[model samples]
Target: MSVTDILRLGPVMPVLVIDAVEHAVPLARALVAGGVRVLEVTLRTPVAFDAVRAIRAAVPDAVVGVGTLTRPDDVAAARAAGAAFGVSPGAYPALLAAAAQAGLPLLPGTMTPSDVMTVRAAGYTACKLFPAAQAGGVGMLKAMHGPFPDQLFCPTGGIDAASAPGFLALPNVACVGGSWLAPKALVQAGDWPAITALAQAASALRA
Candidate 1:
């Protein structure tokens, strides 16, 4: 599926950080069970790729993708590991070119109109707004909407349940990426039910 389609599949995509490879399957299952199917597992841990492969094998319903992609090889590696799509905190010329040619759906990051335009010029209509809260949150998105009406965004970084509703209420936002659905404490404790509950709440924020 295209990046836009993946974004549209759910209202919120959990920005996950899995520390253990063994936690992959159960965690994905809990999120999917709670009504969220789109999952972005950030490559911040050593077991990231293994976790991606594990989730793909264990969870049929979850759409697992790789995040924190900073290099061209990361794209190829993620595709080989069966990532449905890829996300990065920011964009680079070579990285964008490689992902485009690799046919990997990528949501490169953007925090300003110029960044959005640059990604758009490279033929991407959807992008992620990194550090969304610090980048002016809803107001920044609102301002950009006037100029880039066709742009689609998934704002990530420092967003929580309380602030998510405001972000999702915006017309330019497709969804918001957050880590609250599967907090490190919850994941480490193996609290699937609690995670599912959080996912349910986030999924309900579809405005």
Candidate 2:
């Protein structure tokens, strides 16, 4: 699927950091149960690939992806693990090449006009505004809209339920990425029901 198609799968894409491989399927099931199917599992832990494989095998309805991709090998590994897509904190030439080579769709991150231009030059119109709050949040998106009206964004980082609506309200935003839907405490407690509730609330947000 295209990057835009993935972004359109739900109102909010949960930025998950699954520490335990065992939590992967249950967490994915919870999110899917609540109408949130686009899951981005960050490669920040040892068992991340395993978690991805588990979720892919168990949750057919969920569109599983890998995040925190920084290297060419990361792209290969994510593709091997059956990630439908990949996300990075920043766009790089090698990473872009590797993603293209692996036939993996990527939502590369951008924090400035230059960064946007770089990705745009590489033929990407959809991108992630990483560290969104620190990069001026809604105001930055507005400014970007004026120059790159055709560009679409999935603004991530420092966003929560309270502020997601404002970001979604923007004409340029296709959706948002958030970590609050699966908080560490809830995940650690194995509170799938609570996570499902959070996902339900997030899924209801409108653009």
Candidate 3:
């Protein structure tokens, strides 16, 4: 399925960073069991690609995407590791072009209306709002909707289960990206049950 379809399926997309490859499958299974299918595994660790590969190998139903993409080669590396899609904290023309060339659906980050307009001009109908809270949260996204109704957003950074529903309620917000559900401490502890509960709670949010 397409990245947009996958992302729009839920109110929140679990932003995960798997330090141990073994946790990938169980974590994915837990999320899926709790009503989440789309997962963004950020390349913040050395085993990120292996984790992505392991998740894909084990969970055929999960729609996995790569995050923390900053360079063009990062995109290439993710595709090589079998990412279904890619997300960047910020936009770069070379990275965008490379993503298109690789046929990898991308969610480039934008912080302002001008950033939004720039991506729109580049033919991207959807984008990511990084550091969502610090970047103005739902209010900032709402402000842009009037001028760019066609654009969709996946607001990332500082979002948690408590604040997710509000952002998802915005007309422009497709889904929220957050690491709260898969907290580093919990994941490090191999607390799949806790993650599952978090996912279930997050999935209860309405757009």
Query: Which candidate ranks first by lDDT, i.e. highest?
Result: 2
lDDT of each: 0.94, 0.96, 0.88
Residue-by-residue lDDT tens digits, candidate 3, 3-33: 6676788989889988888889999998988
Clashing pairs in model 1, backbone N/Cα/C closer than 3 A: none
RMSD in Å for candidate 2, one decimal? 0.7
Cα error, residue 149 of model 3, in Å, equals 1.2
Residue-level lDDT of model 1, residues 45-134, one tens digit each, is 999999999999989999999999999999999999999999988887999998988889999999888899889999999999998999
Ordered by TM-score, highest first, the candidates read 2, 1, 3
Question: Clashes in model 2: which pairs?
Answer: none
TM-score to native of every candidate shown:
0.98, 0.99, 0.96
Q: Indicate the TM-score of model 2.
A: 0.99
Model 3: lowest-lDDT 10 consecutive positions: 1-10
Clashes of 2: 0
Candidate 2 local lDDT, 1-207, one digit each (tens): 999999998889999999999999999999999999999999899999999999999999999999999999999999999999999999989988999999999999999999999999988999999999999999999999999999999999999999999999998999999999999999999999999999999989972
Instruction: Report how far residue 12 has shifted in candidate 2, in Å.
Output: 0.5
RMSD of each: 0.8, 0.7, 1.2
| Pick by lDDT: 2 or 3, better one | 2
